[model samples]
Every structure is written in C-alpha cells, then in structure tokens.
Target: MSQRVPNILLEQLSDFINKEMGLFFSKERKLDLLRGVSLAAEEFGFSDTEMCINWLLSSPLKKRQIEVLARYLTIGETYFFREARIIQALEREILPAIVEKRRNTSRMIRIWSAGCCSGEEPYSIAILLSRIIPDIESWKIVVLGTDINVDFLDKAQRGIYREWSFRNTPFWLREKYFIKTDDGAYEILPQIKRLVSFSYLNLVQQESPEYLNLQGFDIILCRNVLMYFSQPQVLSVINRFYQSLNDKGWLIVGSSEASHVLFPQFRTVNFPGAIVFQKDLSMEVSRAENVLFDMEIDDLIPATTTNYDFSALLNADNSIEEEAEDEDEFTKAVNFYEQGKYKLAAELFKTLLNDPVFADNPQVYILLAKSYANTGDLKHALHWCNKGVKKYRLEFQLYQLQAEIYQEMGKLDKALDALKNVIYLEPDSFAAYFIMGNLSKQLGKTKEAKKCFENAEKLLRLKERDDVLKEFDGITAGRMIHVIESMKSMESPG
Candidate 1:
C-alpha cells in the first residue's frame, strides 16, 4: 500500500526540489510531486512516503540522495527528432549557413544539448550533420549532450533506444543508423555514437568553476529546459547562453520559451513555423559600405557646374548616415557588453553621447551606466544613472538602474528610495516589488520584505500562467508565484 505525503511536507519538498534542481512544481502538481517521491522512497531505503519526506526535510541533502531523487523526479520523455520543426529549420536554414561560413576556414562545429534527456536529441543532431556535410571524416565535429541526471547520461552513453524512442520518425533512419540487438532494442551505430559525448551538468550551477569550459559553442539547443527554472534563474541562464555562443552563433529554445522579451539582445530570425535567436554581427561594416557608395555617387557629379550647394546636401546626407552609424555602434557596444568586454563597451557608449540624437535615447543611458557598473566604475555609473533619471523622469527603467548602482555602492537607503520612485512610475510592476523584497531583506527589514514579497505574488497571480514577465527577465507568472512561495516557506519558522 502507498502512504500519502502530508500537504505541508509536499510544499516543503516542492521548495527543496525547485531550489536544488531548478525544477518547479506548483500547487496543482503536488500530487505529481507526491507520486514521484513515493516511487523514489523505495530506492532511498525508506519504507513509507512520510518517512522519506521527513528524511529529505530533516537535514541538508547529500549528493547520493539528490541523484536518487533526480532519477525519479526528472522526466526523460523525448524521441529522435522530437520537435520536427526545429530539426527542419536546422537542416534547411541554420546548419547550411554555419557550414557555408566554416567550409573553407575552420572546418569545426560544436553544438551543446543543455538538457539532453536519454541521448536522443544530440544523436539526432549528429545524424543530421552527417547527412548535410560532405567528407564528414575531415571535419572536426563535437555534439555534447549534458543533463543533471546521471542515469540519463549513462543511458545516453550506451547509445541504445527502444521503439518508443523512434516514434514519428521514418523507418529508414533506423535502418541507416541503428542495429537491432538480440533483445530487439535498437542500438545506435558506432559511427553516429562516436560524434557525440555525454556528461552530467546542472544548469543552475553554471557559475561553478567546473562549467568554465562550456563556452565557444556554434549552436546551443536548450529547448524546453528554461520552463522549469524560476524567472530570475531563467534570466541568468539566458545571459550565460549569450556568453557561451561564438559570434553570430545560434540559440534554439522551445516554442513556448520563445519570447523577444527574454532574448531581446539576440536577433529574432523567423523561419517556416519556427523561430530561433542569433547573436548577430555588428552592422557597422554595412553602414560604412553605404557611406562609401554615397561618396562614390557624389564623386560622379560635376562639382563646379551645379547651382546647388552639394557640400551642404552631402552633409545632410552624412547626418542621416551618421545617426545610422551611431545605432550600429550601439549594437556593437551591446554585443561587447554581453561578451564581458566592459571597458570597450563603456568607451563606445560614451562616444554615443557626443551626438544629442543618440544621447537623448534612454537605452543609451541605461546601457552606458550598466557598462560602467560592470567595469567597477560605480561613480561614473551613478552619475549617468542620475542624469538619465533627471532627463527621463517618467522612465521607470532609469530609476531601476539608478537603484542598482546605489545598491552596489552600499547606499541601501537611497537604493530603496530609487525603487520607491520606480513603484510610483509603474504601480503594478511585480518585478519592482520582488526586487524591493530582496532589498528590504538585505536591510534586515524582515516584516517589510514579507509585505513586498506578498505584493509581488499578488501581482503575479493576476497574470496568465504562461505569460513571461519581461520585467522579471522572462519568467512565467506561475513559476514566479512558486518561487515566492518557496522563499516564504524557507523564511517561515518550523
């Protein structure tokens, strides 16, 4: 007979799982959480569900306990070419561009499947690359499949799959790439398996030193993984993804996770029934080309014969071109900022201020200040932030940026005041409330922090479950609510 877990205990387990594994379970999914825990209890040597729950909540979890729990809790439900649209996009558009770019130069390609479950997705990628690239033996290819679950990695390393894993795919793929074992399970061909390597990685622990080698990727497929993370964690992971890619590299996220708000810095490329983000190259070269063409056309005209002041006309044309050039420079500066070249980014952002056209732009102020803040030039960062706030008083983002600079300077009171100004501008901003909550907690204002957290939760509840809160860095409303609940539970006295 199965023993049921108590509601209160289930809530605590939900919080624990979310914090430890970056997986979320809302109130509606408590029964699912209970069932997973119930099944994992036997493996953990617990006789009953209640005892297992108590053991988990009793003390800090050991790594062995976490591994056992991960085996049961995480879902490994994926098939070869699971999302056909993404595969098609890769085959037709994305990969061809990459191959064309590297065909004559590096002859190297790297791809990472961040949440690869049971080895299917990365193998599918290898198979696709083999079909697309000629003389494949000459190319240096690496397709990395990483997951938090060791069991999944072990299964992936074996390169075996059942018929269920081949659902919706053509029979020829099996015949071409897989061999039938004695037990009737399909084993991937040794050649296809050779192209891929499996490893254990927890996305939440990306900041740890072990993951330092996770850079210089050509394409990263993190489909359906970010949905499980809390909003702030999702933002952090996305920012890291931006850093992971080579210049002009691609990022393919799940359809549900596709939001311009989440990936604002990346260029959104729309294909047939699919959308992917790319780290675009700077537009400076193209603008300079345009400038050269304009000058060439001016050179063709007779300079002395024309009654018109062609010089002034050229200056007018140059003025328009200069604005476009500044915008391109801004884009390049943002790329530098994302790449952590903070000093270079700061220098470029300062030049944008010489032109009032770009200076009046509010984002210039925000990024400029952030560039300085990132470089540890807090004084200059605060100065720009305060100037931005003065010029764009109604812009809540400036005040928010100012608050961050103040917080970095350890001026907690001023930071709180800036946040208050943000609330005044946008009364229903849940993110503001959330940030204020953390800031309050930092100041040791426990009661005020609780009130702020509650307010943030209230605002989140009014949004649709799947609506990505852009202010919260693309976390869905439901996940934020769960995150708040988890924080409250941890703060509560037992």
Candidate 2:
C-alpha cells in the first residue's frame, strides 16, 4: 500500500479517466489525491502486491478511478440549515422578489444543490420553502440534488443521519421533522419526503447536464463544493452554474469559499457569512462554451413590486380586438405574454372579464390567472387561481399552480398546504410527493427530503426508459450512479 502514485502517474490517471468516463480531475493537490486512488484499488480487489504497479498503468478504468478518487478524497461537510442568514435571505428577499418580477409567465421554479452528499443541504432548502410559504404545497417546484459519489447518494436517499450532521440545526426543526432511529441516528419523517430529487453528477464531466439544459432554474446552490477544485476547475464549474440558472436567478455559495467576485458574469452580494452571486440572466446560454463573456443586466423588468397579483391581467381591453380578425384570442394572448407585453395581455383579459357572459368560465379564469402570473402580478394571479379552484372544485392543477406562486412569494407554509391538498386529493399523483420533499427540505427536514427524492426516482424509473427521461427533463446521458475515475487503476486479481 506504500507504493505511492508518482506525479506523472497522477496526470496519466486523469487522462485515462477522461478517455474512459468522460470526466477530468486537475492536478493541484496530487499528493492528497493518491490516497483515493489507493482506496479504490482496495475496494475493487485491485490492491494486490503481485499486480505490479506498472500493470495498474495500462487498464482503461484506471482513469475512471481518478474521478472516483476525487469523490473519496473530498468530504461533503454540511448539514441542515448550516448557514441561517442565506436561508433567511432566500425566504424573505429572494423568492418573493423573483415572484413579483416574473408574474407574466408560467409559475415555475427549479433549483439545484450540487455536492449534496448525504442530502442535508437540499433538505435544508426544502425546509426553508415549507416554513416560509404555506401556499407552496402546490407549485411546479423542482429541487435537484446531485453528487459524484453513488454510495453517498444512496445514504442521502435513506435520509437517516447522525447528530454530527445536524450540528447547527435549530431546536424547532429537530422537534418537528426527524425521529431518532433505534441506533440513535436521526431519520427523516415522511412529511418531509415529498419535495426533493437526487441523482449522480460529475462536475468535471465534459457533457452539459442533459437534465439541466431543459430547465433554467431560478436558483442554484454550489456552496462549499467548488472550494476543492483548482482555479481552472473553479472557473469551469462556475461557468456551468451560470448556464444552469435562468435570467435574474441567484447562486448561493459558502461565505468563506473562494471569492467568485472576480468572475465576470456574477455580482457579489454579502449575506451574513454566506455570499449570494446574482446571475446576470439577461441572456440565455449560448450553444458554445466559448461564450464565456460576462453577463449584462438588462433593464427589462416587468414590475417593481415584491409580490405579484395575477388578477391584474383582467384589465386588457377587448375594444380594439374586433378590428383585428387575423389575431385569435389564444394566439394574441400567448404572443403578448412571450413578447413581455403584459399590458396587452392584461387588456385582452380585461375585455374577456368585462363580458359578464364569458367571464366566469373556469377556462377563462385559468387564462386570466396565467396572464397575471406571466406579467409578474402574483396576487392577481392567486386571485384568478382561487376562482378556478372554486369553479373546478377537486382539480389539483389549479392548486399546483397556486403552490408555485406561493413558493415564488416565499410563502413555504401556504405552498405546503397546497401540495398537501394535492396529495390528499390524488394519492397516486406522485408529483405531490416531489413538492412535499422540497417543502420539507426548506424546513431542514433532511430525512424527509431524501425519502421524497427516492419516491420520485422510483416512480420515474417505473416508467419506460424514454418516459423516465422525459419526466426528469431528459437527463438520459449517464447513469444515476457515477463511480469516480481514479479508483479504476488498480490491477484486477487474476
């Protein structure tokens, strides 16, 4: 075991991994890295005295082991609500403001937590959503947790953690969300299991996350994860994170992690010990990775209020519509919404609402709600949501939409209630379980969050391969379990 991996061997290992598994590990900490390589050899029955060190050099998987070595070398050290200030800012300032700003489009919020390890961080985010917004129970909320280590992800899914993981957990969360296992480990309860999702992801893997490309999330938390990487690696990871978030979205990182302020695309904002980097989301991701230019903040905001009112779209006038025969109602409304013409959509909805004969239909109410939501007027959007809920009593779609609006408004409690109603109304929907997991995570219910993610993954896997990929936003490029690269170098026992 003392036969150390040489400097050239480390670079060779990295190149080998890149060829075999499409992942790369830089060489800044080569000395600290061989330990992982040695461990992997032991794990895979390759750590043999007779295997001869040179034999280890030829195997293709030797490279793959390097990536896995990184995972084993790096420990994901975090817990439920490890930092209070960032979560507080998310609840009070970020979500609500974003909601007010995005009322004109579909109410969708996707978030990602990388290097989620044993699931505490994403679960922490879920807990915040549950506590801050009651109506979030029904949103199209997507919280994805990814890590390179498959074994760790398995533990993360189990949601049973030791006390050390909850070192900074608040008393209220401890009381409400988890139950102590027979062995004294704290396990997540079912209430927190319905809102989050997890998968295996390699940060240095050359491919753009297939699952992420389909979703331009509102927030991404890469936190302490990037600190382990070299400067080139850091820049690469940050660029990827930028591509991952939507316009005007935010990225939260550990307070002491390397200062990303020098990175051109992001603006640093201090939040207690945690610092948030606001993504200049004015531009969409370019097809080429070469477009690494700094982002530009656009002045194209739809509204200034912190909370949105969707009912406002009902003000669009119908007077001018009769003269335009070529423009159909749905088309005109959709066009205006897409073009950021909230006022035009509002006028159209207004005309429709003014017509007492056609205004009260549940369909119209749904349209009106969407219009207001598109225009960044969530209050009015909620108003329309309530109307649709009443008109189509027992339908969960309206509730789901409402829940998303509440999440955006940072009303985790309300959002949870909506999701609860959805689950109660349709036990087999499975989507409710996903939302529930996120809410629980926001409440610092790690165990619950993991369960929810597991449930969602189970449901997704039950479907056909294509269907599963479609359901999870088309992340079909790799396996759910990614074994790192460095570990593959050891000689296999004959």
Candidate 3:
C-alpha cells in the first residue's frame, strides 16, 4: 500500500522542484507533481511520500536520484518532424542558403537540438541534412541533442523508435532513413545515426564556460522547452542561445514561445511558410537587394516624358541607387548594434545623420541613441533621444528608449517620467507597466510595484498567449504572467 502525501508536503515538494530545476507547477499541476513524487518515492525506496519529500529537502540529491526524479516529472511527449513547417523551411530554404554560403569555406555546419527527447528531432535534422547536401562525405556536419533527462538521452542514443514517433512524419522519410526491426521498432540508419550525438544538459544549471565554450553554431532549435521554465531561467537560457549562435545563425523556438520581449536582439525573418529569428550578420546585403528589387524603373521615368534629358534620367537613376546603398549602410549599422559592435554602429549612424535624406528619419535617431547607450555613452544617448523626441514628439518608442537610457544612468525619476509618457501615449503598453513595476520595486514601493505588475499582467492576458511580449524582451505573455505571479508571491507577507 502507498502512503498518501498531504497538501502541505505537496506544496513544499512543488516549491523545491521549481527552485532547484526552474520548473513551475501551478495549482492544476500540483496533482501531477504529487503523482510524480509518489513514483519517485517508489523508485528511490522511500517508505512513504512524506519521507521522500523530507529526504529531498534535507540534503543534496545524487546524480542517479536526480535522474530518477526527472524520469517521473518530465514528459517525453514529442515526435519526429513534429512541426513539419519548421522542418520544411529548414529543408527548402535555410539549409540550402547555409550550404551555398559555406561551400567555399570550411564547409562545416553545427546544429543543436535543446531538450531533444527520444532523439527524434536531431535525427530528423541529420536525415534532412543528408538529403540536402551532395558529396556529404566532404563536409563536417554536427547535430548535438541535449536534454536534462538521462532516460531520454539514453533512448535517443539508441536511435530506435516506434510508429507513434512517426505519426506526422512523411512516409517516404522512413523508407529512406530507417530500417524496420524484428520487434516492430524502426532503427535509424548508420548514415543518419553517425551525424548526431546526445548528451545530458540541464539548461538552467549549465554554465556559460561549459556550454558556450564552443560557440558559433549555425542553427539552434530549442522548441517547447522554455515554456516549462521561469522567466529568469528562460531569459538566462535565451541570452546563452544568443551568445552561442554565429553571426547570421538562426534560432527556432516553438511557435507559441516566440516573443519580441524575450528576443529583442534577434531580427525576425518571415519566410513564406514559417518565421524564424536570426542573429543577423549580413543585414546590409539583404536590405540592399530588397530595395533594388522593390524600386520601379517605370515609375522613376514618367510615361508621358517625350524628351526627358537622358543625363537627368541617368542622374535620377544614380540617386535612387545611392539611396539604396545608404539604406544598406543603415542596415549595416543596425546589424552592428545587434552584434554588440555598438561603437562602430554609433559612428556609422552619426555619419548617416549628416545625409539630408536620413536626417529626419526617427528610426535613424533611435538607432543612434540605442547604439550610444549600448556603448556606455549615456550622455550622447540621452542627447540623441531628446533630439528624437523634439522632432517626433508623439513617438512613444522614443520615450521608451529614453526611459531605458535613464534607467541605465541611474536617473530613476527621469526613467519614471519617461515611462509615464510612454503609458500616456500608448495606454496598453505592457512594457511600460512592467518597467514601472521594476522601478517601483527598486524604490521599495512594494504596493506600487504590485499594482504595476497586475496592470501589466491584465494587459498581457488580453493578448494572444503566443504573441511575443515586446515589453518583456520577446517572452510570451503566458510566461510573463508566471513572472508576475512569482513577483506577487514574493511581495506577499509570510
């Protein structure tokens, strides 16, 4: 007979798990946690669930014990080609461009599948890569699959799967990449098997030195994982992901997890069938191509022009071409900003400000301010932001940018004023309220902070769960609500 866990003990265990592993269990999830704890007690040979919870709380858990707990608590609910559009985008668009770019270089491509369960996602990538690249033997390809669950990693290492894993996978893929086993399981072919490697990685616990030592990956897929983590943990992992990617590398999260708040640094690239974030390296080149393609030559020369000066026409064309080049330079500056080459970006942005065409562009001023701010030139950043506000008085983003600079400079009052301006301009601005909450908290005004957080949460709840919370850095609204609730809990008295 199994011993029952009390509600108090269950809450303690839930809190323990959340703090240690960064996995939150809501009121509804507490039952699931209790069930997992019961299973863990049985596995660890505890007499009762209370005894198991006491043991976990009293001392540091062993590696094996942690693995046993993970097996019970974490769900391994995934399939090969789970989101087919992402895979299709990789196959038809992303991989080909990467292949062509790296053809003359080292011809090396590295991909990471974070939280890979049962080895399906990474193997699918390997199989896809194999199909895309001709003369595959010449190129060095690496697909690393990592998960906290040792059981999942072990299964992934075996590279064998049942029919359920291929529920959404195309039929032709199985024929090409897998062999049927006598036990009715399918084993991945050696070709696909050799391309992938699996390892145990706790996303929350992994240090920068250990995980980011071998940076400059071509692509990273961390889908459906951040949804399980706390805001701070998710932010930490996303920052690491940003550092891990090479210039122009891609990061693909689950569709629901995409957020402007969480991924403010990444440039969102919308493909025909999918959207992926990129650490943009060649922004200028892409911008220039788009500009050229978009310009209508017929529009430039009026259809009624009977005796248009050929030299004037040529000069007009030359001006349009120069404008495109100037736009390209602006994009290059923005790219520099994204890459943390802020000093270089600031210089370029300043030079562009001298151009009459760009002088009045609010975006140019905003970028200049951001670049200065990033490089620790708060004085100049404030100056540019002020100038932007004077020129575009109603621009809410300018005020928001000013608030950020003020906050960075320790001008709390000024930051609050700027945030107020942002809120006044855009009443539904979740970011402004969130910032106000942080500012209030810093000043020890717990009540004000709590109210601000509540306001932000209410506004966020009104939006789609999957919509990137631009105010929170690209984290989803669902995740921000968790963050707010956590903050509210801390603010509450014992």
TM-scores vs. true structure, each candidate: 0.56, 0.51, 0.58
What are the Cα lDDT values of the candidates? 0.74, 0.58, 0.73
Candidate 3 residue pairs that clash: 259-468, 259-474, 260-473, 260-474, 261-473, 261-474, 262-473, 262-474, 262-475
Tell me how far candidate 3 lies from the true structure as C-alpha RMSD in angstroms: 15.5
Ranking by lDDT: 1, 3, 2
Task: For candidate 3, write residues 28-105 as lDDT tens digits.
Answer: 467778888888888888868888898998865656766788999887767786564466568768999999999999
Residue 5, candidate 1: Cα error in Å is 3.7
> Which digits, one per residue and each the tens of the lDDT, describe model 2 over residues 1-494?
65455667677765555444434354534544465666766665675522433455566433345445545655555667655546556766787676555544665568898778879888877766666546666566677888777777888888888887766455556666788888988887665657788887777664635345535888988765553443345567777777777877788765434244334577666432234788775534353244332311100000011112211122222112222569757556655543345667667766776677656655566666766776568899898788778778787767777776786577888887887777667766545665666566666665875676556556545555323222122122121111111111211221
Candidates in descending TM-score order: 3, 1, 2
Query: Which candidate model has the greater TM-score, 1 or 2?
Result: 1
Best-fitting candidate, measured by lDDT? Answer: 1
lDDT of 3 at 118: 83
- Provide the lDDT at 242 for model 1: 79
356-381, model 1: which lDDT tens digit per residue? 76888998888888777766788998
